[model samples]
Target: MPKPAIFWDPAGLELDSLGSNSYLRSTDGDTPYVSLSIRMLSVDTPETHYPGRSKPARSDEKLAELASWIQEGAAPIDDGLAAHLQPKLETGRAGTLHGEQGEAAHEHFERLVEEKLTKPSGRKRRVYLKSGNEPFDRYGRLLAYMAPNYTRAERDEMTPLESASFNLLMVASGWAASFIIFPSLPKHSDLCLFQEEGRKAVEDGLGAWSDPLTLTGYEFRMCVKLHTVTKELMQGKKLSKAERLRWIDRYCCDMSTRGVYSPQDYYRVPAYDRIFIWKKDVNEAVARLNLSPEV
Candidate 1:
């Protein structure tokens, strides 16, 4: 499936002239007319396109087994995570649950954007965007954290957490998972806040967390990717060194270890310890973090 799209914008010359300062024309230097996608920073909502019949297909059944194995690998990070996913995996309904939660997250997210960006008079306001440490992701999408375009004085009225970026709010509200990656990890103060919010959300069983089977967006995508290879491995097929290395590069990163690992070793890294890094960004991530992958 194509990558999901959200928080994308196409800024016109008029808005740029009005000082929105979106500089949406980054992708089109000569024309100054095109828009680009924005991959919101530090949060990931559920997968919206995973097909589901609420009953396991042969493929779904296979994926379920593979997912369970991956969950076991992640058990060291948080035993509760694998425990939480167990019921749905056993019933072969993991994919269906993911799709359902994805829909719920989408609807809630839409309402949130409307509530945050609409003036009481019903006119819409532009969202506030702060670019990430890196300007763009490997997908060419701008990476940003968005919030209401409140003035500094207006924002001062609210507590910092209340005024926090929608990215953090999404995690606080439990509709999305905290997904901060290396180099984009915020300063200590803000990082503490995000962690607190995430802990609270999980404790409160809010949104998708209310459903024990819900997979974070990253986990959902990983299951989709690794299932096929996992199936081959299960059948006793051996990968050549190049293939093994390629799959490992594409497959493993752990949050707890803050290290990249081979798929066989990836499960040892623990859940929530996994971080997202695109293939092209691996070199940069390695350089920035001084990582040594488990080859």
Candidate 2:
């Protein structure tokens, strides 16, 4: 629990959201400075907007299929929460809001920020970026635990195991999923804190946790990738209902240890296990080709 050195540039970065987790940040708040897309680290919220206008992510039919799989698998949702989640689950099913709970998480975070801005006391704020062991993600976004206007000095009195991470706050508040990209980063405190918070949220049936589905960002990515890879193998052939599940079983077993990327790939979760939590949509897509369940 030794303190990692804080990475901070003296000049403030002007941070504004392009969407839920992505931000457009500049070196200076007023005068122009080098700007880049800052995606919050270790936090993945349900996306509320489309990727068409921003830095492009891999968006295609396969991704759409992945989204639908996540939602469809979460069917027969709680009646009390279904109303708010329907829009997020069904909106632009081809691209945005693919999860069962939809954009509720996105809206929740936005509303929280907006409320902070309109506070009558006019609280002063600063963005604190705590660089993790790995500073850049595959997408070229800086991987740092970001806190808007909160600082280390505020938490100096706390013990080594304590965390004041806004990123952790998101999970603690049930607004984001705990996305651990690098497990060996000596980030035990924050990692443990987020896991505890995430578990509690799930136990309380909050946000994405409400569906009783919990996955790291890397796990989610692997689920989508696994589906795409399986589809490619089938090459549009329709499989019988029984064959569909069997195919998934075979694919997962074969790819369990096969490296999806390279030596540094962080998706350690096996495909076979992820199948139970991540395969509904892919199953339906294959089922559609056959038309008849028995076929």
Candidate 3:
């Protein structure tokens, strides 16, 4: 059962009410509650933190530039973004735009919260959560999609678009891009709706999409991973392919080409077409989503 808890951020990443008022669980003694970290499903906002406060992306500086790393034999994330970020690095602005756009995305999401999840009385509205098949992400954040909790009357009065999940609303609002992953994939109809909203968001250049050079939150994480990997390689650490892939998450399906692509190819796949999958799940996803294997 869901509990009333304070959301710490617009992305629904974590909750601040760590004790009595918390998400997911209550201890047998009832004095404390387990803190739940949630990685919201179906959408990803821009890269928000540098010198980050958490793990996975524990900041080692946003190594958005690919030239030196590429010169060191590291693969380029994507040609255009590589060039786009290169100057920023050369001119000492490498991580600035990433952080700026992240703030922009967060502020945009707050506006979305007010518009989509606020009540007429100015209280925060209720929401329903739909989780993915796998409940916990690698970072231990619970994965979910928060939908507006509406009465039948309210549902009847609103259009499907208006009655969207907060996940969808984020995409529609233009701050978040469509971020579907395998096995956790929504129903086909919902996926189509996500694509439509994403199309509009991109076309309108809303939020992160407005900044042509902005990396999707996922891509930012990947670049950081690559940098980390390159760092280890630079130190001559002996790492297996699997061990190397463990932290650098970029595996996915390319919808346009109907093929699976590894993390390095992630930037080539557009947000709407990219279906992120953990490295281990790529085989299962191929069978489940019916896409071709990596070429």
Candidate 4:
């Protein structure tokens, strides 16, 4: 009973037998530009070469076989019959055998990039104003939210337009985070409100957070963390009072400022109950305001 033969898709490479000096062609019509053989350099012994088989070999199996052969110090001969075959031999020894697997993974990664690029916007635009300068207001909010500790000089260094854009992006990230963290909270509607507010903030010449790339990156992490928290919450596992307070504080800070802090910061600032208070205010505001458009 011979083992079932497995095959790999050889994109464009060939392997020869141990003794016969014959050219082997890959099933995909790819002919290697070289021939390989096993030889005893001490004596003028006849070289053995394996002609390429009609079908591809399984990648795993091919790797195993290649590993065994390399251990035997096989010499490769280029089809061009060049002076040396060191490059090809080195390539084989380095395990460059699975072209098909590489191709498949590349395709999958490309699809993911395409999906991200094609995401659609689902909210109405709204503008907010502050200090007779919409851009400034938006930027102020963004800086306050994102890099609160930044000095006035830092804020002044940014152009009004840039600040507004940054703030809008920060708002977008917050809305995106909410969707992932609380899927049941009418995400579409919240997004609409967020967009409207962001636009208003921008139009009023208020500084708005700009920088979709940064916001997207932050949202990516937030979504992952939110999923973990949501699953734990749904499990009916009671969080300790301290744990619940910590989560509340963290969520508040993230929502209000789009800022994240380490666990050490959370413990150090137990005195700053403003986060807890602000969280309650925001929750109440969301509840009172019919922000979600009826689906």
Candidate 5:
């Protein structure tokens, strides 16, 4: 029997509409940059009130109810339920230490608290240095290895016609960025047609940003703007396939211009890095679905 089709959506991330957040607007003009926010949704939290019920139902039951509520558009969780569950969620068994590892973890936790307390009121503070020793590195490595493999599998799982259509979308998205960065490339003219095909794919996906005509216009201007900025870099007669790919990587991943400047003037902030990294992951996931083989 054929395996079930999988649909993926990255949770807890939101794409803010233009003008919703004042800080996200471009400094010189009204153009908007995407602002991503992460939200915590606790599954252990209950939603209803049933006075004197047997221990307020099991944890698994509450989780199931939460899923149902979300599917039904997330009805407001009452204070009574939140009050009962919050303590349970917060309370966890203390770690049993056998060696220096326990002491180190405790020390790190205390240092984090001290740093948080030292920050000035109304001022932005840095958190989580980019050192590879952080707790999340193991998970990151696993994901990095798995994603490309998953993409390859996903691609092979599709029918021949589906593979052709999906690959066309990937090429189109690539070309959209390409036209902006290196219009002098041999296949530059093909971008316009590829872009139209991309629009159709976006519409079919029913994505939040799916507006074919508007996206096409935006992409055209984006290509022109990118060309203007990187013209000098692309000066030598023609850029190779690898060089063009590098330019696309830089163009889509460039958050330098969107540097944070607020209560603190820190140019490179931890939050900025985290958000950008998460955005890159989501973008790659989208690309994998389009171009990689299924798992």
Candidate 6:
């Protein structure tokens, strides 16, 4: 019998673009680029491809206030454990935010990927993509909590987001937002961890949080063109009758009469590229319409 395919591999790795968050992989020893886009799970960075406009400067007082918020928002722990774990929890504090700081983050990520995964200098390093439950995002991107530190057993034991996740690092360093699109998904555990990191970033006044003009995650997502479908879904707005019907046909959308179902019950809807509706939002839509599940 053949051995199980290992999750981490260092073979045939090539990074295409750091700005768009894409890379190439060939674990099967085939040609790379077979996987076009590999998204860092649970976070979204500002557009390095298009740096739109200047953001306002954040006040020093504001930064201090934000940092304090992070320390307070940390999850509750036993007093005995809290004192000991406090230093470890602070590990995430020493990070750099992506777009907020400069285009440096894109270059930083590229360099990190090269050093950790592609470097053939000594013993080649292995990178792992932990596809916690929901393997693909609605955009068809391979949604994964990436671990360049997979070789470290202690890091592997930590939750992917809590460990050395390229995704969470972006958020922790203030490079990205804790963009929790599908809150009800199995990756919620990872999301929670990323959220904590994001709070730390905010508290530390890292990245976009330091920019007065930079929007909060909710505000930014609502305004971004990439998140149109998500904004519409969350705001209880409909594009058209036909569009609604199509969504129903594709994603089992019974928005007219909120239906209750597990988030796991739904799969990727083929019709839409990056459309996603939270299970609770769908249920609320269903109840709002007072329509039966059949609708």
lDDT for every model? 0.66, 0.45, 0.69, 0.29, 0.28, 0.45
Every model's TM-score: 0.68, 0.49, 0.76, 0.18, 0.16, 0.45
Give the per-residue lDDT digits (tens) of candidate 4, residues 144-195. 1121222357449864333332222333332211111211122334334444
What TM-score does prediction 3 earn? 0.76
Q: Who wins the lDDT comparison?
A: 3
lDDT of 2 by residue, 116-186 (tens): 33424687465567776556555556677765553467457554323355667777766676554432122
Q: What is the number of backbone collisions in each predicted candidate, taken in the order shown?
A: 5, 4, 1, 46, 11, 13
10 residues in a row with least lDDT, candidate 6: 266-275
Off by over 4 Å in 4: 1-164, 169-240, 243-245, 249-279, 291-295
Q: Give stretches of model 6 more than 4 Å off.
A: 1-35, 50-102, 114-122, 152-162, 183-192, 216-221, 224-281, 284-295
Best by TM-score: 3
Instruction: Give the runs in model 1 whose Cα sits over 4 Å from its true position.
Output: 1-31, 50-59, 65-88, 234-237, 241-295
Model 3, runs deviating above 4 Å: 1-37, 54-66, 72-91, 121-124, 138-140, 236-247
Better of 1 and 4 by TM-score: 1
lDDT of 5 by residue, 41-141 (tens): 10001111122232222222333343344234332323443333223222221011111222332344345334433434545333221111121222121
> Candidate 3 on 1-295: residue-level lDDT in tens?
9886876656442333343344665567765555555688988877766436543233424463344775454642456555544543433344566667777778877777677777777877777888889776766566898887888998999988889888888888788878888778877777878888888888888877776656667656656666777677767888887666655564778766778876666656667777788777877877876888665
**Relative to the unseen true structure, what is the C-alpha lDDT of residue 99 in candidate 5, on a scale of 0 to 100?**
14
Residue 282 error for model 3, in Å?
2.0
For candidate 6, write residues 57-90 as lDDT tens digits.
Answer: 2222222333333356432222432333233223
